[model samples]
Target: MTRPLLSLTNVTVAAGRAATAKPVLDGVSLSLAPREIVGVVGASGSGKTVLSKAVVNWLEPPLTMRSGEVLFEGRDIYALRGADMRILRQRISYVGANPMGALDPTLPVGAQIVEKMRAVVPGTSRRTAERRIIELLDAVRIPSARNRFHDYPAQFSGGMMQRALIVDALVTNPVLLVADNVTQPLDVTVAAQVIRLMKELTTTFDTAVLFVSSSLPVAREACSRILVMDEGRIVEEQSTDDLVERPVYPYTRELIRQTPKIWGETVSTSRHDDQREVVLSLRDASQSYKVRKKTGFGGVNLVRAVRNVAFDIRRGDSFAIVGESGCGKSTLMRLLCRLELPSSGQILCAGRDIATLKGRSLLEFRGKLQMVLQDPFGSLPPRTAVGKMLEGPLRTHGWRVEARIRERVLKVMGEVGLPTELYEQLPLGLSAGQRQRINVARALVLEPEILIMDETLSALDQAEQFKLLDLFEKLQKEYDLTYIFISHDLAMVRKACNRVAVMYLGEVFELADNERLFFDPGHPYTKALLSAMPTLEPRRYRPEECLLEGEPPSPLDIPAGCSFRSRCPQAVDKCSRLQPSLTVRERQDFAACHLVLPPTASGGIGGVGTTVP
Candidate 1:
């Protein structure tokens, strides 16, 4: 029995003085058997995340686990002594939902990994620790483990960095590995890839995994047993298959219905394509970040984020690009809108190459292609009125200062569901969802033909995601606008995208219809990515799910082969030796991995040292 790897007996987390701050967790109890994978699901602020943090012996300050006992291998963890507890803590790791919080910019990623590894083994020399580090990196599929081991956090992309942090968490080989909202943000394919990797890692190590997320479908796919929490209380618990088949709780059923799947009405939209032409087109589009040292290690650090990645956005079309955090999804969005110019690529917008435009031309182009960034808070200025925020873009584009701008602001704000009184209120004064409304209103002000949405819905509530998604579709159809939807949430991508492109390590690994990409994936990397999507679809089980543990290669040290070959389940000997170029796989579907197609007749990927000329 192994005495059940871990168990929470009558766990309750309270925030205020004993009877003051309400309880965040209410008598929640769960147990994990050795090597068993369990998932906890709930809405945001449902206390699922709080419960894991409590169990990992990290209640931090002011917050206490109240009366619950956290048992690790039959021993009470909350009652453990300082040094003794640290030892136990070293054996149990928590990979948080927020990756940015875990990484320290001052240190290189490799050193960070090794540093965690060194903690578990006391006199282990740096060299020995480094060796273990290599093995660990190898396990995560981070190519050139030795070279990147010393690279700082800034060197990695969002998903790669997340993977690195996960590797660091697993460095201790803990009996209990708790993952919070691990794959909710990834697109179906990329999310699927990450999910598969996590499952594989947990399986290979025979570690008990506790997955916490707000997605019921995701939890259903990743865990055999599922627990549903609402407002900090466990309302339902059952086997994954049983729950999906017969959910006893109404809220749980509603959650499953809303969870985005490969092809589902995750969000209902009335947008029809007959309303308009191609709004924005990228012909051989590429974007390079002249790195020039991310943290002062200068000389030559330019990153060609999106190299020769091509796609189009038709009028009223939602073209979603899905990838792990750092897979150039945002870069592609920026490049398409000319927010960042391509080193050598043509972005034809309204039949003009906006890449070479400058001065007034560039300024005017900005009005036509507005971007709604991922962080809504980041979108607004401090003490700036939401009304003024909307008017600035209008004013910048030469909108009159009179009643016209005010009228436009008030109207768009209303469309976003904000009150007219909010016109003068600062963005800081509003709630999270309201601030996002401001973001949407501001972007729609210019009524740009092309809207580059970079993770715009990531911070909003599910209800909010649905609202904004509806607003986007309505506007798209009404104004005949185009959208380049960038997100990690695959379900959203599936629901939103007419066409989808999957990016990996700054390259488009696969591009196709959303259904084709998810259902009949041709690229091995694409298949792995789809498999990695944490799905509640119990019927679509694959053994490869257990092999997706490693992170992607560093963009700086990208492998010469297919960018995804390192993690591709179908990777062959030819993968590492040659690069894979994007080509038509089936119908409109395109992929860059050799696992899907053979190397080109030229004997290698077209260009050398660069992705596409």
Candidate 2:
């Protein structure tokens, strides 16, 4: 019976001139009550972003509002002008996907937010603004809010920057907030915390929210009601529980089906074989960098990126390394492929120390171990044709004849599911999935035994990811290839990887087969990550019990003892005095936690945490 805080009726948005406009949002209608959270779910190019931008009238040129009425407090927002429009705009805030680009690089993040606050609120003293900003920052769970306020945007991590952006959006105490894919770039734990924070803040501030995301599970976590968008139209709308349990539209059903499951039936069969030859191995390998301090002093800080990492990849194994951002997954990937020599220890490729190799030996190592980098578009050369791009690796490795090179390039392209017709086409207008396939083809052209996929599928949508995963499975079987996946996508890992290594603060917390790690993890951090993962199935680990608080300690100043103990909930007295080494918890499972008792003990397995039905 309460009046809706915002309403859109028969809203239609289109691109280009009137004579040749194409619809982006077709007859979309929705209403948000006070303090209510509504979600819009769809795949890429589904017009979800357009609808969010339309709510705040932030759409630019080429995006024309064809027909619609957007009402704020029962008043037509489009009819308002000048001061009225400015005031209305101030009452609605939008937070986008990229928090790093939102704040000015030249100014302290807090100063930029305060500047906006004064501009909109008017007559607010600097001291009062600072107090309010810091309060909101703390409310969003940024540790040492006062100290971090003076830190530059570059100083804050991805999760911290996102929380700061939320603080900026809420500083005005708007009646409505439009969050567009804000959590897409964050880690699972960080995303869960942000979602929980938004729920609490919506109640505290009595503000409605329009949560837009490509991920259905993420939307389900934060919203009461969901709207499924497809090709600029609202295909279906229902309560979150009812919609997820029984969807009405085909697209919605497909979206639900495409969402990777974590606790469901195993998708990838066991491919682990200890008898197989070890393709790659690491022995106490470590890496670090000396970064200069921001104070213009001559002193520098040592960033311990990777420390004492030990792992082995057998032929035909699908191994994964998963952790939050800055957890040394990337550094380990570099070490595995010999991009950088380890500061200490050894990285052995086929029983030969990679760091000791030079000239022809190094070239041979490069040929044997190829890498497919992240950022599909950025990794590819825009001007180069797809065929030529794929051929470069083959040419570098000595495929002399042009005819033979073209033949090999086309064959690799087919293996990655790229059409032959695209061989001569430039990568400029190609889709992200297509560009990534080219990268995969480029790596595969080398006929390498080991392939390191560094967040290779993160840029893709659910459907594209599924297709690529299937392709990888086929290639693995045919080529006898070994895969090293470095990613934050636990769902994909759950479905695709055979073995997993959980890392935290540059240390491997747990390593085990996929089933054991997912079903019965020994380390608390692994449990926390599983709990924080967004999935449709009922959670195995309760978030309230397992979710970590705040962020990991800075790599530059890692704590003594256990690096994870600072945020760990079950830390004991001994955890502060001594660090636990990787102890065998089961036949092949290893965990570095003080609380986990060895299987020989009466406590069968993982007595540290409880699970939910």
Q: Whose lDDT is greatest here?
A: 2
Model 2 regions more than 4 Å off: 18-20, 294-297, 600-613
lDDT of 1 at 554: 59
Task: Quote the positional error of residue 36 for candidate 1 in Å.
Answer: 2.6
lDDT per residue (tens digit) for residues 1-613 in model 1: 3577888888888885568778989998888988788989876678877898887878766677778788888889877897878689677888876666577889787777777677765777888877876787777766566777877776665566667777888777787888988765455554555666678866787777899876676676678899989988889999988998899999888886765555333344323344457667777776666556546555776565776777666776788887766778777776776667777768787788886688899888888888888776666798877777788888888877689888888888777688898777766656667777777788888877778888888765565676677787778777777788888776567667777888877777777776666666656655555555555554343645523555666566777766676666556788888887876654456767554542343244432111121
Model 2 per-residue lDDT tens digits across residues 1-613:
9999999999999897585688999899999998999999887788988999999988898898889899998988888888988788678999998888898999999999999899888899899999999999999999999999999999898889999999999888998999999888788999998899889877899888999988899999999999999999999999999999999999999999889888777666465457989888899999999998877779898999999999888888889999998899988988887878999989888899998999989999999888898788799989988888888887888789999999988888888888999989999878888889999999999899999999898777787888999999999989989899998889989989999999998899999999889998988899999999999999999998999989899998988888898888788887888889987776677899887766655355553332211
Model 2 vs truth, CA RMSD? 2.8
- What stretches of model 1 exceed 4 Å from their correct place? 1-5, 18-20, 60-67, 73-76, 113-128, 185-206, 261-276, 288-304, 323-327, 382-385, 398-406, 419-433, 459-464, 502-528, 538-613
Question: What lDDT is obtained when candidate 1 is compared to the true structure?
Answer: 0.73
RMSD (Cα, Å) for all candidates, in order, is: 6.0, 2.8
